[model samples]
Target: MDLDAEFKLDDDLCYLNHAAVAPWPLRSMQAVERFARENAMRGAAHYPRWMEVENTLRENLARLINAPSPRDIALVKSTSEALSFVAYGLHWEPGDEIVISDQEFPSNRIVWESLADQGVTVRVVSLDGDDCEDDLIDAFNNNTRLLAISSVQYGTGLRMNLDKLGAACKAAKVLFCVDAIQSLGALPLDVEKSQIDFTMADGHKWLLGPEGLGVFYVRPALRESLKLHEFGWHMIANRGDYRQTTWQVAPDATRFECGSPNTMGAHAFQASTELLLEIGIDKVEALVLNRVELLERELNKIQGIEILSSRDRQRQSGILTFRVAHQDSQALYRDLMSRNVICASRGGGARFSPHCYTPDAVIHTAVERLAECIS
Candidate 1:
C-alpha cells in the first residue's frame, strides 16, 4: 500500500508525533465517511452490518494481541476505562499490594493508587537509575497480588522485557497486566506468550485510528476473577431478546463491554487494523526501528543534546526523546511546533516519535528545524 498517499498529510507539516495521535489512513477516513453517510441516509436499517464490523474489530484486536480467542476481547471507550475496570473490579484484601513502575503515565499510576482507600498498598518500582529489573522484582513480596506496568513507557519509550516479567509474576503467583497503549501498534504483542492476564490500548496513537475507542484483552480463566463493575442490556447473553426478563451476563470477555458499542470508531479502527495486518507486524517493527535509529543517529550528531531513550534494541521501541543543552525544553517544543515540526513535550524534553510510514525527509526536516530553533 502507498502509505504516503494513504495518509495524504500536508506538505508543510512534519508529523513526527505518532506517539501522541496519528493521522488516519485514507481507507479509515473513507470508512468513517461511508458510515456517516449511511447513518444519514438509511438510519438504523443496516444495524446488523454495523454489528458485523464491530465483531470484525474484536477479531482483529484478538489477532493483534495474539489472544487465545476473540471471546477474550472487549471493546471499550478508552484505555482509562479498561484500566479502571481492572482496578475496581478486583476484590482487594487489606494489606494486599500492587507493584508498578514509577515512570508510568498518570493513567496507569492513578488507577492503582485509588485502591489505597481499601487498604491496598501501591508499590512504585523505579525503572530509572540502577538495576531496573531487580528494583521492580524486589518490590514484590508475600502480599503482592498484582504487577502492572506499561509494555512501553510512555515518555521515555523504555520497552520492558514482558516475557521475563511474566515468568517472574507467574512464579510469584501475582497477576500480570500490561498497559499497551504505546506499544500495541508499533510492536507486536502476544498476550499468551507474554502471559499477560489483562491488557488495554487506545487506537488513536500507534493504531492510527481515532480516540474514544480501545481494545481490552482479558485472559479466559482470569475473566471470572474480575467482578463485573458495569452492567447493561448489551452485556447480557440474551441481549437480542428485548422481552426476556431472565438474563445472564456473558461468561467471556464480552461482559466487560457493558453498553452500546462505538460503531463508528469500530468501523474506522477495523479498517486501520486491516491495513496493519496486511503489512505484517514484523515488517512494521523493522520499519519503526529503522526510523527511530535514524532519528537517534541524527539527533546524536547535533551538539549539546542528551538522548533520554534507550540505545539498546531490547529496551527501545518507536520513541526517541532528547533535550538541548542550554535551551528550555518547552521553548524548543514551541519553536518546533511553530515551524510545523510536529512533536511532543515528554520525558522532561522533546519526544519525536515517528512511525513506519514517516518519511525520511520529515525526520531530516525535524532535526534541521530543532537545530535552527536552538541556534
Candidate 2:
C-alpha cells in the first residue's frame, strides 16, 4: 500500500504531531463523507445499516486490544469519561491508596486525585532511574487498592513494561487501569496478555480519527461490580421494549454507554482502524519505531541538540522529544509551527510524533527545520 498517499499532507508542511491531534486519513475522510451524505438524503431511514457499521467498529476495537469479546467494549465520549467511570464506579474506603506514575497525563492523574475528599490517597511514583517498574511495584502495599497509569508516558514517550506491571497487579490483587491514548494505534496492546482490568483511549491521536469518541474495555468478571452513575433508555437490557416500565441494566459493557452513539465518529474511526488492521499492528509498530529511530539519528547530527526522551530504544514509543541548547522550547515550538513543521512543546522540549504512515522525507524535513531554528 502507498502509506504516504493515506496522509497526503501538504508538500511544504512536515506534520509530525501524532502525539497531539492527528490529521485524518483519506479513507476516514471518505467514510465521514459517505456517512454525512447518507444522513442528509435518508436520515435514520437507514439506521439499521448505520448500526451495522457501529457494530463493525466495536469489533475492530476489540481486535485492536485483543479484547476477549466485543461485548467487553463500550463506546465512550472521551478518555476522561472512561477514567471517571472507573474512578467512581469502584467503592472506595477511606485510607485506600491508588498508585500512579509521576509522568501521567492529567486524565490519568486528576481522576485519582479528585478522590481526596473521600480520603483516597494518590501515590505518585517517579519513573526515573534504571528500575522504573521496581519503583512502582515497590510502592504497592496492603492499602493499595488500584494502580492507574499511562501505557506510554505522554511527555517522554516512555513505554512501560506492561507484562511486568500486570503480573505485579495480579499478584497484589490490585485493579489495573491503563490510559492508552498515546500508544493504542502506534503499538500493539493485548488487554488479556497484560492482565489489564480496565483500559481506555481516544481515537483522535495516533488512531487518526476525530475527537469525541473513544473505547472503554472492562474485564468480564468485574462488569457488574462497577456501579453505574450514568443511565438512559439505551442502557436497559430490554432497550427495544420502551413500553415496559420496569428495566434491568444491560449485562455487558454497553451498560456504560447510556445514550445515543456517535454514529458519524464511529464511521470515521472504524475506517481508520480497518486500515491499521489491514497493515497489521506488528508491521505498524515496526514502522513507527523505525521513524522514531530515524528522528533520533538525524537530531543527534545537529550540534548542541539534546534528546529529552528515554535513550533506551525499548522504552521509546512513536514520540521523539528533544531540545536545542540555549533555545527556548516554547519559542522553538512557535517558530516550527510558523514554518509548518507541526509538533508540540512537551517536557521542556518540542515533541515530534509521527505515525507509521508518515513519510521519511517529512521526518527529515521536520528535523532540518528544527536545526535551522536553533542555528
Candidate 3:
C-alpha cells in the first residue's frame, strides 16, 4: 500500500502527537462519512450491516493483538471503561494488594487508586532503576492480587518488557493487566504468549481511529471470575431472542458491554485496523522506530537539548520526549505549537510521538524548527 496516499496531512503542519489523539487515516474518515450518510438517508435500515462491521472490528482487533478469539474482545467506549470493568467486577478482599508502576497514566493510576475504600492497597513501584523489570517483579508478595502496568509509559515513552513481567506474574500466580494505549498499534502484542489476563487500549491514539471506541481483551478462563456489574439486553447470551425471558450473561467478553454498541466507531476503527494490518504491524513498528531514531539523532546534535526518554533501544518507543535546558517546558510547547509543530508537553519535557505514516520531511522540518526556535 502507498502510505503517502493514505495519510493526507497538511504540508504546513507536522503531527508528532500520536501518543495523544492521532489524526484519522483517509479510509477511517471515509468510513465514518459513509456511515453518517447511511444513517441520514436510511435511519437504521442498514443496522444489521453495521453489526457485521462491529463483528469484523472485533475480529480485526483479535488478529491485531494475536488474541485467541474474537470472543475474548469487547468493544468499549474507552480504555477507562474497560479498566473499570476489571476493577469493579473482581471480588476484592480487604488488605488485598495491587502492584503498579509510578509512571502510569492517570487512567491506569486513578482506577487502581480508587479501590482504597475497599481496603485494597495500591503499591506504586518506581521504574527508574537499571533493573526496572526486577524492581516491579520484586514488588509482588503473597498479598499481591494483581499487577497492572502500561505496556509503555506514556510520558517517558519507556516500553516495559511485558514478557518478563507477564512471566513473573504467572509464576507468582498474580493477575496481569496491561494498559496498551501507547504500544498497541505501533508494536505487536500477543495476549496468550505474554500471559496477560486482561488488556485494554483506546482507538484514538496509535490505532489512528476516532474516539469513543476501544478494545478490551479478557482471557477466556478468567472471564467468569469477574462479577457482572452492568446488565442490559445487549449483554445477554440470547441477545437476539427478545422473547426469551430467561437470559444468561454472554459467555464471552461481550458481557462487559452492557449497552448498545458504538456502530459508527466500530466502522471507523475497523477501517483503521484494517489499514494497520494491511501495512503489517512489523513494518509499522520498523517505520515508527526509524522515525523515533531519526528524531533522537537530530535532537542529540542540538546543544542545551536534553532527551528525557530512555536512550536504550529496548526501552525506546515511538515517543521522544526532551527539554531545552533552562527553559520552561510549557513555554517551549507553546512555541512549538506556534510553529505548527504538533507535539505535547509531558514528564517535564516536550514529547514528540511520530507514527508509522509520519513523513521524513515532517520530522526534519520539526527538528529544524526546534533548532531555530531555540537558537
Candidate 4:
C-alpha cells in the first residue's frame, strides 16, 4: 500500500512531533467530519451506528495491545484519568511503597506521589545506569505494592524492558502498571506476554488520533480488587435501565468509565486505529524504526550534535532527541518551529518524532534545516 497517500500533511511543513500530538490521517479526518455532519442533520437518529463504532474502537484497542478480551478495555479521557483510576482505586496501607523510574512523565509520577498522605512511599529509581531494569527490579521489596513505569521514557525516548520488569513483578507478587503512550502504536505491546497487570495510553501520539481519548487495560482477576472511586448510571451493570433502582458496578473494565463516552473522539480514534490495523502494526513499526534510524544517522554526521536518546538498538524508539553542543535547546526548538520543521524541546534537547507515513523529503528537509540552524 502507498502509505504516503493516507496522510494529508502540507507541502511546506515537516511534522516530526508524533511523540506529542500527531496530525490525523485522511480517513480519521473524514470520519470526524461525517460524525459532525450526522449530529448536525439527523441528531441522535443514527445513535446505534455510533455505538457500533465505539464497540469497534474497543475491539481495535484490544487487538492493538493484544488484550485478553474487549471487556478488559475502557475508553478514558486521557492516560491521566486511567492512572487516576488505578491510583485512587487501590487501598494503600501506610508505609506501603510504589516503585517508579525517575524519568516518568509528571502524570505517572504525580499520581503515585499524591498517595503520600496515606504514608505510601514513592521509590524513584534512576534509569541512567547500564542495568536499568535490574536497578528498577532491585528497588522492589516486601513493602512494595506496585511498580509503575512508562513503557518509553517521554523525554529521552528510552524504551524500558517491560517483560523483564513484569517478570520480576510477578515473581515478587507486585502489581505492574505501564504508561504506554509513547510506544502503543509505533511498536508492539502484549499485556499477557509482558505479564502486565495494568496499562494505559492516549491515542494522540503514535496512534495518530485525536486527544481526549485513550484506552485503559486492567487484568480480569484484579478488576474487583480496585475499589470504585466514581459511580454513575453508565458504570452500572444495568446501564440502560433508567428505572432500575438498585444497580451493581460493571464487572469489567467499563467500571472505570463512570459517565458518558466521548463519542466523537471515539469515532475519530477508531478510524485512525483501523487505518493502522489495515497497514499492519508490524509493518508500521518497521517503517517508523527506519525513519528514526535515518534521522539518527544523518543527525550524528552533523558537527557538535549530541544524540541524547540511547543508541542501543533495543532501547531506541520513534523519538530521536539531540542538542547542538553550544546552542540553547529552547532557542533551537523555536528556530526549528519557525522554519516549519515541527518538533519539540525535550530531554534537554530538540526531539524529532516521525511517524511511518512521514515522507522521506520531510525527514531530509528537517535534517537540512537543523544543520543550517546549527551552522
lDDT of 3 by residue, 1-375 (tens): 899988898899999999999998999999999999999999999899999999999999999999999999999999999999999989999999999999999999899999999999999999999999999999988999999999999998999999999999999999999999999999989998899999999999999988999999999999999998889989989799989979899998898888888899998999999999999999999999999999998999999999999999889899999999988899999999999999999988999999998988999999999988888
- Candidate 2: C-alpha lDDT: 0.92
**lDDT digits (tens) for residues 101-183 of candidate 4:** 98999999999999999999999999999999999999988899999999999998999999999999999999999999999
Off by over 4 Å in 4: none
Q: In candidate 3, how many clashes are counted?
A: 0
lDDT of 4 at 47: 93
Which regions of candidate 3 are displaced past 4 Å?
Answer: none
Candidate 1 TM-score, true structure as reference: 0.98
The backbone clash count of each candidate, in order, is 0, 0, 0, 0
What value does the lDDT take at residue 279 in candidate 4?
A: 85
Measured with C-alpha atoms, the lDDT of residue 30 in candidate 1 is 99
Instruction: State how far residue 262 of model 1 sits from its true place (Å).
Output: 0.7
Clashing pairs in 2: none
Better model by lDDT, 1 or 3? Answer: 3
lDDT of 4 at 295: 93
User: What ranges in model 1 sit over 4 Å off?
Assistant: 129-131
